[model samples]
Target chain A: MNILAQLPVIPIILPLVTAPLAMLMPSEKMGGRAPFVFATFVVWAVFAACAGLLHSVATTGPISYHLGDWAPPIGIEYRIDLANALVLTLVSGIAALVFPFSYESIRSEIDRRQISYFYAALLICMTGLLGVTITGDAFNVFVFLEISSLSTYALVAMGADKDRRALTASFNYLVMGTIGATFFVIGLGLLYQATGTLNMADLKIQLAGDKNRMVEAGFAFIVVGMGLKAAMFPMHLWMPNAYAYAPSAVSAFIAATSTKVAVYVIIRFIYTVIGADFSFAPAAFAWLIAPLAIAGMFFASGVAIFQDDVKRMLAYSSVGQIGYMLFGVSFGTEPGLAASLVHLFNHGLMKGALFMAAACVMLRVGSHNCSAYAGLARRMPFTAGAFIVSGLSLIGVPLTVGFISKWQLLAAAFDSGRAWAGFLIVASSFLAVIYVGRVIELMVLKPAPADAPEIKEAPLSMLVPMLILVAANVYFGLHTELTVDLSERAAHALMGAGR
Target chain B: MDILNFFAERYNYWIFITLMMMGLYIVISRGNLIKKLIGLNVFQTSVFIYYISIGKIAGGTAPIYVAGDMESRAHGGGHGAENGGGHSAPGADGADALPGKDALGAGALHADDMPHGDFELAGNDLATLTGNAQGAHAPALHAAPDAGAPIAGAPDSSGANDILAAPALKIEEHAIAAADAVKEVAHQAGDVVYSNPLPHVLILTAIVVGIATTAVGLALVVRIREAYGTIEEDELESADNVAEFGAARAQEAVA
Candidate 1:
């Protein structure tokens, strides 16, 4: 096979191989800053590989690489269509930025000895997420999902150095995540029993338009399971604490990528393997998941307005953001799915930037609460500046990436004759404004308390990546070729491929 | 009749439901961290049983057919395989067949001439089938070398008989006979109908994941113990509530 043929598995394998080596770089006799450099190199390589994969998928349509030439329908296949290619690029692209940002950002947040190990864990987590996105095998998705979830539990608990609350948060997540994963496995087993195949493409062919009870039960199981992982409302209990307690760099990376990938899996299972034609699926999406999406938007954003802790507030806001993505899914039309995919990409850019800004604040002020942020705009000007730009994006202000998502989502809603849902989206934007406005008011309008800690602007390491993401928010907002057009194409590909 | 068959033949589903619910009940009802993990293990084990049982065919043998077994059974007029006598697919068909048994007898794999491996063991497994059948098996039992036997009791394996009770071993011959008696059934002269191997293979991968989950869960509990000094969920709750809000608010929240 040529090098390009082997490109799909590299994003998964390269980081998995290099992460351990990076972790081992800090031995007592041979210690240096090499581990950080190596980990950064590894993430960027993965990012480049994903870019190549995306290019290949765009040019050639979908690329399916069977593991070791084992052939599809029997062996595991790494399917790189437009849909997963977009998600792969988003995840690795976030990891690429977050790695260098974390070098300086996590210094005050975690123990010194745990730094290299933390980077390694981050690499493994990235690999797992990438693996989940690329595989066409249903059970392989579970395998990679667990790989990521297991590491995430450890990464979130690493916050225990800062607060014991992180421990409880991690344990709570472990219990819930395990139950969620097992539910997913049960669903997979049922699918395997019905079709006698684990490959997603094969399952689609075998399950073509047959709305039997076994498939229906499996569909329900798969949704609820992935719902918990994607931080779908009511099942999103693990998310806020996990994000709030994690190291700031980790909070940024995970917020930007992990739940987004879970959202991708939900889309994959529903539209691809299960197909929208299933008797129960469209009805369920309209009745169960869509209403939950509307409820989460109101409930979480309203709750975000009351939170004293900025990190927890942002985490709640993330739940509300996911509601927008799922709301797009509820429409069940091509434009609707396209709108969902667009938000998935745009949300990654915006949320990732927002969290990195919070990280810069955490680096200096050493507090997660909004009170710590009182009128530091003059002192940490760049940090507050980046925060304002990203915060505006979060509020769906014009000429930022957030507007693109809300515009398309609203358009899709109205196009599908769900004009009330469009109104709900607008109303939710107001809730985002209230919550985001509270923080903006703190950073901009309010005066600094006289006793504010004598703080400087964020370090170059943090500011550089945070600014790059913020710039991308403006860049892609102006240029819809990448986010809007590509996502719609991805949507068309997914819809065509599914049926 | 269909309903009765549905209930009776599908006892595995009933047992799966029972074990699954029991594990879930334990996880939900327990407050102790370790007990919750134990419940999770039970829950995971039920899934494992469900998957592995799904691989079982009611009348089929294990999916473990040796390439060597097929080769030996190929040389019908010959003594045993050049690779040494291995247990076979059906039995050696002609001159090497069993005494007083039909040369075409399906499961009666006469191993009187075998030099190595589990042909004797395969026959002795049928000792439970009929007491009178196996004095002929006595000399072969001692000669059944453990070396080169890939699967020790493999030849006796019906996928159903493997996980089933010891008494199901006796039904292997009858199952094979009853299977052959049906007109719709088809087989080669030597091919053993194997249960689907894919589910078992899938379960093996799943078991690895289950172990990892258990290990990670326990490790998280260890960290939790170090942090909170307790693994009880309620105690950790009160401790977290106190840590989050002030003592007064934590008390009110608890109430």
Candidate 2:
């Protein structure tokens, strides 16, 4: 047995184990920097494992690691299909990039004594998202989800060191996130009651064509639950304030991974566990998911246009971006699902780069207000340039990741005979251009106030990782082989699993 | 008459739904942060109860193995599996055991071509170990408990002295032999109605997650109280609003 077969669980366990060890490191001397350095090393290693996992899952059908040598249908299995592997790589890869950037990002937002705890919480959050993505059992998803949510609450609260409002933001998120998680568990219970299995594969076998009300109720509960976590429209009240008030590093990392993983869960449940062939699937996809998705895209992008706090604006934009993904899922066709999956990866790259750029600006400017960016292009040229490029990408400009997502989504919509949705998508994207354009106007076109404080470029450690993410945004935008091929394969795995 | 019968037949579900709605009501309708966390706990606890009750085999005992089956193996969390990852026997990564093929490429995943990676690595009978849990329900289990009640609020603590069971039920680690032994003993007895151990184990994990969430939520509340001098949502909201458009926001933060 090669270690490659054993690779699926490493992404979860390595961080799960490191988080505690990181906390125990002495608070004196290099111990102050030890947590950050250690976290970076571990996250990069996880990225390697996740990349390897994707390659292996691509080659070996799917990799299922039975926890403790126990066989599945019984043991808690870590299953890695192409969809999961792609998401795992995206999450870990973003985390790996964000960790290095946090060296400077957190320096301003957190106190020295709390630095270790911050890194610890970040690692645990990483462990949780990875676990949620990799697990094959339905209930295991809940366990890992809560692990992430709890840590996320604490991570957000750590920002109280910078702004007292972060405490309230974290508390609000806690209440909402817990409710969402509980709803998920309730759904799991109903599914278990109907099928007598918590193993997802086993549940699928049992649920293939059941017209069972109990199972249907479970599906509704799961969608709403995951929808709340995914920041589905109308339920996204917590996101803006939470992202706005959070430490920059926390905002960037969570923005790039958390909601995307939740959306993946929603897709997994709709297509895989419940099966698209189920009686409820078509109406739910068309009326429920698609409409909500389109509304969120327009509604949120409109709200984002007015936000003075740039981070919060990005957060609102995140809600809007999620709409395109859901819009793709609404089609319930292979190409449509592939579009969502592709956008899923591309959005993570775009947001990770954008938020990191925001962090760089925050470090230098001490503000996230649009007015704060006046003449920022002259003062902090490289950071402003990164922001401009990523902002353009967010607006779906050509030769950027955002353009790829929009192109695929539009194609999927047209193919599925939902040409109206394709139009709506393009229309919503212009809303993106409005908000993105406003920020670009402040950063580039306007001049700095005469009394404006001098600002320096972000420290090299932060700039390197931030620039790397920006590079990935462009590289993947041009290089469709990796993202598009993997996404299509991931979509196939998800579409096939239900059958 | 039909409506009454519907409620009567699923009274356990009635309890589940009532508890769920009550908890949800409090969470949405309340203003205090601490109260909201309490509501969340109630909501989560209801789910635990719901799951436990579902795994309720009528007249079921706790999931410990019966007179023939070795019941002690369950204390190690029912599945009695290793702690995942670190304990795996090395070369477990030998991807060769899993038949290599691109999923969307040449070979479509047939049941026959399915890679039994774990079983093959352990050199166990891949079929018996399970790909067996396929096609859903196995035969009606014999009247017997399999093992473990780690969930504090578990409904099926049958014959247990306390939460999920006693110290005698504790088994830190179970070997492959333990699983075989339990199966053999279960086959012999064939008469005990045992709770499926899975939900018990799952609820146990959920309970821990619940506790951690409560702890974190309460911790945030404490910080909120310190920072804003209040924990009520209205008070916090007013404070944030004042900060949002006020120049005093910058001055106070500096102070």
Interface RMSD after interface superposition, each candidate: 8.0, 8.4
Model 2 spans with C-alpha error above 4 angstroms: B68-190, B246-255
**Candidate 1 per-residue C-alpha lDDT over A87-194 given as tens digits, one digit per residue, 9 for 90 to 100:** 999999999999999977776778778877887889999999999999999999999998898889889988989987887788778888888888898899888777
Candidates, DockQ? 0.22, 0.27
TM-score of each: 0.86, 0.84
Best by DockQ: 2
After superposition, candidate 1 runs with Cα above 4 Å error: A27-32, B1-5, B66-191
Lowest summed lDDT across 10 adjacent residues in model 2 chain A is found at A24-33
Best by TM-score: 1
Cα lDDT tens digits, model 2, A1-499, are 7876677788998999999988877545664789888988999999999998888888878888899887767567888888888899999999999998898778787877888889999999999999999999888898889889888998998888889988888888988888888888888878876765677886787787678677888999898889889999978988998999899999999999999999999988887788888898998987898889989999999999988889999999999999989989889999999999999998998888888888888888888878788988998988988998888888899899889988998888899898898899999999999999998898888999889988788899988988888888899889999989988988887888755
Error of 2 at A351 (Å): 0.7
